[model samples]
Target: MRGTHPSRRLGAGLLTAGLISLGLLPVPAQAAADTNLALGRAATAGGANGGYPASNVTDGSQQSYWEGPLGSFPQWVQVDLGTQVDL
Candidate 1:
């Protein structure tokens, strides 16, 4: 009991496909950038008492954790945009 037919169906299908194809564009171009500074400062003498590294220490110790051996860990940690991605 179909009515108007295959021609109408074909036209509708093509239109739908075209619209969907056009929708597949608009991603970030510049990308995103994130980095961890990884800072560490030694604990103030025995103030650390007994706890995590000076960096994670929650006590009120004068000794703080600052950046540690740069080479030992990721130094400048960076994220390049690589290439301008198409959106």
Candidate 2:
């Protein structure tokens, strides 16, 4: 049987270290966890006088967004994640 070249072994080691440092290696417990809690969730704004509904925020489209009425002070938009999050 042939042994792996010294340069090849060093390259493989470096690649493994890089992946571990970047968190690409999966953890056993977290591999199956849901990381994003706000995907496709409902969103609502205080007002949509210009036809920009609050749901636009979660439609996964860059062209659309929730726009508050012009000249309105203290505008606000809210999203419901369906569960409490740490942030």
Candidate 3:
């Protein structure tokens, strides 16, 4: 039977030690719950094509999108989260 290489044995030992240390480490407490606070919320855009409205930005549908007019400079979109959130 062939013996395992010294480097391979050392690598495997380090990997095992790392995994065991990670398991013994204390885990952080869960932060605030995760939720999409932007769903169905109010949204406004600087400008849009005739048919496309600013509300489409938060309609939760990729098929629909707000179309800004051509040659419009400094266009932007904004969403209201209804409440201030801490970053």
Candidate 4:
């Protein structure tokens, strides 16, 4: 009540209740933080096709994709996470 708008508080509580009832809320998630661990990290690849550097994969954009040189078999790309993390 103090420093709080009644309607706003009610609206928030109602929304939370609705989401929970609809099963849209994942309460008490037992997992690591949902995040892109490799975004903007240092990356290295066997090779690239023109502008598609190894960093493209870790740039966090689906539209932009990395490509290996043509006719290259078993191409590989590596991203450094700066530290070990749970997969």
Q: Over the full model, what C-alpha lDDT does candidate 4 score relative to the true structure?
A: 0.88
**lDDT score for residue 62 of model 2:** 76
lDDT for each candidate structure? 0.43, 0.79, 0.79, 0.88
Best-first order by TM-score: 4, 3, 2, 1
Model 4 regions lying over 4 Å from their true place? 1-33
lDDT-best of 1 and 4: 4
Highest lDDT, which number?
4
- Residue-level lDDT of model 1, residues 1-87, one tens digit each, is 859889999998898778766865443433332432222323332223234343443233446533333335342222233445553
Give TM-scores for every candidate, taking all chains together and pairing residue i with residue i.
0.25, 0.52, 0.54, 0.58
Worst 10 residues of 4 by lDDT: 26-35
Could you give the C-alpha RMSD of every candidate to the true structure, in order shown? 17.4, 9.4, 9.4, 9.8
**Candidate 2: stretches off by over 4 Å:** 1-36
- Give candidate 3 regions above 4 Å deviation: 1-34
Candidate 2 residue 39 C-alpha distance from true site, Å: 2.9
C-alpha lDDT of candidate 2 relative to the true structure: 0.79
What is the RMSD of candidate 2?
A: 9.4
